[model samples]
Target: MTTLRRPEIGSTPEPLDLSFPAMPDRLGEVRRQLREWLSRCGIGADRAYDVVLAVSEACSNSVEHGYRHGGGLVRLSGVVTATQLLIKVTDHGEWKSRDEPSDPRRGRGLQLMAALVSDAVVTSDADGTEVEFRIPLDPRLSS
Candidate 1:
């Protein structure tokens, strides 16, 4: 007899491919959709919570600082590999210097996100800002 392996129900989830118009009021909805998507990707409860928090922080910053014209858009994507979950949030507002710290209290979102996720990166260009974070479920949390 051969033992078969199949994707468990709700275990193998698809990547998230979605975009939203950049509006300060839509931030909460953006985070909600992201949270559900991450949950479906088999991410642990704790990791999913972190993803929600980090993504929300990044998006809020984009809305507040990234877009000066207030009519841009925020692009969000999630790609799950065997070992890690990758989330990319991109905005087409303006290029911010990657080295400067806006403020500890108001700008500390990125700092907290960096500490929560396995990896956090912020890239800025003439087009806009792109923030990426990877959440890894290690043996300690995957149980």
Candidate 2:
């Protein structure tokens, strides 16, 4: 597990860092922590909802696709800056490539994430896969 560092008093809060087993059951806890952290950063309800949804999609993909052979760890980290909130979901598992989803109702996680955030990027290699989201913050609320 990653140990989160405490921020200095009166300074910007530390980024949210979480490391957990990459399982479907852990998603609720991830969502809860993310919601709380974004709320503390003064993110409004609507935008926060989008942020959570987008981040969740990334985490879900990590859980579903990253570990084809066995289980691994998933790391979620978020940093809020004056202009944007940057969130990354990383998994330590072999990367799998699929041409298409076997089910017609699935495989849209990437699209949904991209639509919900200012920017979304996915990178994968032999070691693992990582998804990053950059969400613009409201200038008025970022202060």
**Global lDDT of each candidate:** 0.72, 0.78
Q: Which 10 consecutive positions of candidate 2 have the poorest summed lDDT?
A: 1-10
- Identify the leading candidate in terms of TM-score: 2
- Tell me the RMSD of model 1 versus the true structure: 6.4
lDDT of 2 by residue, 1-143 (tens): 11122222254557999998888999999999999998776676777788899899889888887876778899999987766677899998865577644677777888898888758899988778889887765554333
lDDT of candidate 1 over 61-93, digit per residue (tens): 787778856678888898766556778999888
User: Residue 60: error of model 1 in Å?
Assistant: 0.8
Cand. 1 Cα-lDDT: 0.72
Off by over 4 Å in 2: 1-11, 141-143
Candidate 2 lDDT (Cα, 0 to 1): 0.78
